[model samples]
Target: MSPPDRKEAEVRRMLDGPHPLVPPGLGLRAAVRGRRLLLWRRRLGLAGWLLFLAAVAFTVWAVTQQPWIPPPSRTTPPLEGW
Candidate 1:
């Protein structure tokens, strides 16, 4: 037989064979893992939003306060003459 036909026959034979055994608890374990993954993703998303808000708040405060400018002198300059 041709290589293609041989491959097809081999595949058909494998499909006709009995299926492998699966663990009884596989579905329960998968469900628990899926729930944990969803919770972790939600927590990560909330933390990302909180960090973004904090950064925006800090930027706004800095702009309004203008902390870079020096404070005014407390006392007046000395007299020019005695």
Candidate 2:
């Protein structure tokens, strides 16, 4: 049979049969794991924000400086002598 059909048959067999008992304190273990994962995710998010802000600041400074553009003339009085 195909992989999907095989998987469906296995699921059907499992649903028709009785389930095994949970070991003890499953909820407590799951809660502790979830809390640790949450804290890890928050720290990663803070670091990502700091990097993003630094890039934006660097871009702003580079564009505003515009060292390549020539400075404007103080007085425009260049007429053709020919």
Task: Write down the lDDT that model 1 would get.
Answer: 0.95
Q: Over the stretch 16-80, how does candidate 2's per-residue lDDT look in tens digits?
A: 99999998999999999999999999999999999999999988987998877888989988888
The CA lDDT at 60 in model 1 is 100
Collision count for each candidate, in order: 0, 0
**Weakest lDDT window of 10 consecutive positions for candidate 1:** 1-10
TM-score result, candidate 2: 0.56
Q: Which 10 successive residues of model 2 have the least lDDT summed?
A: 1-10
Judge candidate 1 at residue 21 and give its lDDT.
Answer: 92
**TM-scores of all candidate predictions against the true structure:** 0.77, 0.56
Judge candidate 2 at residue 14 and give its lDDT: 94
What is each predicted model's overall lDDT from 0 to 1? 0.95, 0.93
